[model samples]
Structure formats: structure tokens, C-alpha cells
Target: MARNQQNELQALQDTLYFIGGKWRIPIINSICNGNKRFREIERSIPGITTRMLSKELKEMEMSKLVKRTVYADTPVLIEYEPTEHCRSFGKIIQEMIKWGESHRAIVLKKRT
Candidate 1:
């Protein structure tokens, strides 16, 4: 159709690619909220397994949005922190949260 419609569709695709999968954005939001360790993230997310958390953390690390560090002492602990790149999109995430809340409210109002 129109050039603007094509651009809009492309942007939607890019956004989905940027925040794909069930665990990615939740992991990002959890890390952003100061859940810095693997166990802590698992604990905060509640239903995520240790294995899945580790896998997602590694993926985010590779994607450059999350930083993973391991300290070589005793049991060997690993910590996860969001990179500056992830923090740069704070406004976008905030807007998504706001939009979701507003949409839910309107939909609930219609239902009731």
C-alpha cells in the first residue's frame, strides 16, 4: 500500500524482533528493577526455571542488552546487569506499560 504503511509495518516487525519470546522483556524488566543475579532473577520471575533463566541471560548477553559477570571464588557466582543500550530504551518500555494498562482498563470497562 502506501509508503507510510510499509514503514509502520516494518517498525512493528522490528519491535517484535527486539522484544521476542516470553522471557526476554520480563527478564529485561526484572534486571532493570535491580535483580542482578541469576538466582535473583529466577526468584523474581517465580515460574522461570534456572536452566531457562541461564539460557535467556546468555542470549541477552549476546544481544548486548545484558552483561553477565562471573567471579571466580568458592562456588563461582554470576551476576546480570543491563547494559547502557537497554537502559536507553527506558522511555519506550514505560510507554508500553502505560499503554497496556490503559488498554486493559478500557477493555475491562467495556466488559463490565
Candidate 2:
């Protein structure tokens, strides 16, 4: 492949790897939509098990996609918020949502 094509391919691969898992994007969307607490995030995404959410959050923190903050209160509270790096991907996610809606409409129209 040409040098430019190789670079583009690598970038696409990185993006795919980042958003590879079934839970990652939904987790990000939940957090970005103001679901900070663990339970809140869990409830926002139906069909995600407790174990999966815990595992995904840890991985996301390691990837610098989310910040886990623990508040020392009478009852300790933990919250997860999207990091600046993750926030940068918000526009792309929005576009994907738009595209998905449009694609579904087209497919349904064809079936009709």
C-alpha cells in the first residue's frame, strides 16, 4: 500500500481497537449522558451485567477514556466521567447515531 494509505489504515485500526468491545461505546455514551455513578451507568444500559460493567470501567480507566473519582463522604461515593480524550470522540458517536437512524429507516423502507 502507498504510505498515505498505510497511515490511514493504521489510524482506522486504532479506532476499531479502541471501540472494539460491545460494552465500550455504550459505557461511554452512558457516562457522557450524565450517568456518573456505577449503578447509574449500569441501569442506563440494559442487558449489561454487573460484572461486565465493572470490568469495562476498569479497562476504560486504563485507556484514559474515563476518570474514576471517589469522594470521601460519610458514605464514600464513586463517579466516572469521560476524560478529555474520550470527550473528543463524542462528535463521532453522535454522527454514528445519526447514520444508524438513517440506515434503519432505509432498510425498513426497503422491506415495506
Candidate 3:
């Protein structure tokens, strides 16, 4: 591969390493949209088990995409929110949404 191609491939790989997964984007969307509590996130993303959500949240936190806050109280409150870096993904997510909608329409049209 040429030097430019190699650089582009490396960039893509690094991007995927941070946000590549079936659940990561959904989880980020939920948190970014103000679903802070753990239970709220689980509810927002149907079919995600507590164990899986917990693990994914930890991974996102480590990646600096999600911020985890804990409040020491009678009923300890823990919340998750997207970091500025993750918030910057809004445009990308919107583009993905538009593509997905168009793709779904095409797929449905073909099936009918």
C-alpha cells in the first residue's frame, strides 16, 4: 500500500478500536441523550443485559468517551454521560441514521 493508504487504514483501525461494536453506539446514544442512570440505559437499549451493559460502560469510560459519576448518598446515585469527545460524534451518528433509513427503505421496497 502507498504511504497515504497506510495512514488512512491506520486511522480507520484506530477509530474502530474506540467505537466499533454492536452495542457501543447505542450505549453512547442513550447516555448522550441524558439517560444517566444504569437502569435507564438498560431500559433504553432493549435486550442488553445488566452484565453486558456494565462491561460496555466500563470500556467506554476507559476510552474517555463516557464519564461515570457517583454520588455518595443514602441510595448511592451513579450516572453516565458522554464526554465532549463522544458528543462530537453527533454529526457522524446523524449521517449513519440517514443512511440506515434510506437503506431500510430500499430493502423493504425490494422485499415487497
Candidate 4:
């Protein structure tokens, strides 16, 4: 393969390694949709447990998709907010959501 093609393939692989997970997209979306607190995220995603959410948040923070802020207080509160890098994904996710909804409508209507 050409150098340009090889670089492009590697970049795609990195992107997949970064965002290819069951929880990453939902975690990003929840943060984008205004759930910053840990509990808030847990509540926003119906089936995610505290442990899994915590792990996902930590991973996102490491990947720079989310920022973690801790307030200096007697029981310090931690909030997870999406970084600019993550905000860039908003348009993509919006398009995906539109596609998903359209597909769901067609499939469900066919089923019923």
C-alpha cells in the first residue's frame, strides 16, 4: 500500500481503539447532553452500573474526551465534562442518531 493509505489505515485503527467500545459513545453523549456528575451519568444511562461508569469515565478522561474536575470540599465532588475534542463528535453523533432513528422506524414498522 502507499504511504498515504498506510497512514490513513493506522489513523482509522487508532480511532477505533479510542472510541470502539460499548460505553464510550453513550458516556460521551450523556456528558454532551448535560450529565456531568457521576451519579447523573449513571442515572442518564439506565443499565450502566456505578463501577462500569466510573471505569468508562476514567478511560475517557485519559483519552482526553472528557475532563475531570474535583471541587475542594469535605466530600469532594467530581464532575466529568466533555472536552473540545469530544464536542467535535457532536455533529457525527447527531448524524448517527438520525440514521439510527430512521432505520429503527423502517425496521419496526416492517416487524409490526
Best by lDDT: 2
The Cα local distance difference test for each model comes to 0.84, 0.91, 0.88, 0.86
Candidate 3 lands at a TM-score of: 0.88
Model 1 lDDT per residue over 1-112, tens place: 6999999999999979988888778788888888887777888897888888888888878989898888997899888888988876655777889999999999999999
Question: For model 2, how does the per-residue alpha-carbon lDDT over 1-112 read when each residue is reduced to its tens digit?
Answer: 6999999999999999989989888888888888999999999999999999999999989989899999999799999999988887876888889999999999999999
Question: In model 4, which regions exceed 4 Å deviation?
Answer: 1-5, 108-112
Task: Count clashing pairs, candidate 3.
Answer: 0
**C-alpha displacement of 36 in model 3, angstroms?**
0.6
Clashes by residue pair, model 4? none
RMSD of each: 2.2, 1.2, 1.8, 2.3
Candidate 3 structure quality by residue, lDDT tens digits, 1-112: 6999999999999988877778888888887787999999999999898999999999889989888889999799998988999888855776788999999999999999
Rank ordering of all candidates by TM-score, starting from the highest: 2, 3, 4, 1
Q: What is the lDDT of residue 87 in candidate 4?
A: 88
What local lDDT does model 1 show for residue 89? 62
Q: Would you estimate the TM-scores of all the predictions?
A: 0.82, 0.94, 0.88, 0.83
Q: What is residue 89's positional error in candidate 4, in angstroms? A: 1.6
| Best TM-score among the predictions, by candidate number | 2
Model 1 spans with C-alpha error above 4 angstroms: 4-8
lDDT of 4 by residue, 3-98 (tens): 999999999899778778787788878899889899888998888888998898888788888899999988998888888889888557778899
lDDT of 1 at 22: 83
Order of models, best lDDT first: 2, 3, 4, 1
